[model samples]
Target: MNYEGAVYRPPSEARSLIIQVTIGCSHNKCTFCYMYKNKQFRVRKIEDIKNDLDESRIQYREVKRIFLADGDALALKTDKLKEILEYIKLIFPECERVGIYTSPQNILRKSVDDLVLLSSLGLGIAYLGLESGSDTVLENVKKGVTSSDMIEAGKKVVKAGIKLSIMVISGLGGRELWKKHAVESARILNEIKPNYIGLLTLLVEPETEMFKQIQAGEFQLLKAKEVLLETKELLNRLTVDGCTFRSNHASNYLNLAGELNEDKERLLKQIDDALSWKFGTKDEMYRRL
Candidate 1:
């Protein structure tokens, strides 16, 4: 496949075949993100995309999954996305699912009918970054959307029969707003009730605005115990039934995974163990973005 600067997909899509349908994030203004800073945003040519698909058919014999990359594949026009989906069905009849990353703006741009059409055409799941559900944190980080906007967008995706995977940063509120961040994030998750909820801890990278803020002593990162306490509070507030929750990302201090409501107590107990120093967190030296 023809790849661009940097391609990113959900960790669950680790084994899937990836193709860049877009060059970079269309709204690459999140202060915490530096993933696509070096690349310009643009939809790839339809012909080039098709060529890559054709080459992939020749390369892999039994492709089961495909992940559209870089950042916002759903930002493409409805007709254009339909064409790509149709071609994928024709070329890889056995492919079971196709997933993509979508921002709130991308979701808002597409009509419900457009989303339904895409879902019907084998677009199985969409990964959305909620970042933080606290409006203060969101605005501070320039997430470009409110908590309510994300909730509405997530509901739309679910209404269209597309599985939604929502991600939130654990320490996004920093030390000052940690409590509000935790509670509001849980509130948003309870409202959306997404199929998947991924909790990733914050890791400020070099060259990003967040890194500069940390350097200037403007933002205070949460300590390991504080992160656990925040997560426990968030989990305690979460009431979404049947929602799968995961916080096992390499960036997370603790690895937590289970279905909500049922395993809530177990997860909370694990957090307690970590807080009491009975269990350990991922070493800070090993954490990554």
Candidate 2:
């Protein structure tokens, strides 16, 4: 496959065959992200993508799942996306599902009918980064969209019958706006009620703007204990009916996984145990970007 710099996908797509449909994130200005900093944003040529699919057919016997990479594959026009999906169905007849990372901008750009068409073409899932739902936090991080915009984008995806997986950063707002981050994030999730929710702890990467801010003391990263407290508060306010929640990323101090509403109490107790030192937390040395 012709992969570009630092392709990223949701953890659940670990087993899927990854193809680079786009070169980098369309909105790569998020202060906290450096994943696609080395590359310029552009869609891969259709012929090149088709060639990769052909090559994959020769390599794998039966590809069950495919994940389009790098960030913002859905930003491509609907006609182009439909062509790719149609070609995938032809080439990988055994493929059961296809997924991609989508930005709120892309979601809003595409009409609901466009999203529904993509879903019907076997575009099974979309991973969205809701970093923090507080407008203050979002502006601080340069997320490029408001909380209401993200909620609307998510709602459209869910309405289109696409499985939506939304992710939020644990310590995004830091100490200054942590409370607002937690509550507003919970409110957005409650409104979207995505199929899956992922919580990844904030870890600033060197050379990123966020790292510079932290060094200057403009931002205050939450301590491990504080992250637990923030998470507890967020979970307490979360009211999604059947969302599956996960916080098992390497960056997270504590690993948590459960279904919402039913498992809310159990998940909260786990956080409480961690906060009280009754459970173990991941060591700082082992954490990664």
TM-score of each: 0.96, 0.96
Regions more than 4 Å wrong, model 2: 278-289
Looking at model 2, residue 130 earns an lDDT score of 97
Local distance difference test values of all predictions, in order: 0.91, 0.92
* Candidate 1 clashing pairs, residues 3+ apart or interchain: none
Worst 10 residues of 1 by lDDT: 280-289
Evaluate residue 279 in candidate 2 and report its C-alpha lDDT on the 0 to 100 scale: 31
lDDT of 2 by residue, 45-102 (tens): 9999999999999999999999999888999999999999999999899999999999
Scored by lDDT, model 2 comes in at: 0.92
At residue 178, give the lDDT of candidate 2: 93
In TM-score terms, candidate 2 sits at: 0.96
| Deviation (Å) of 16 in candidate 2 | 0.5
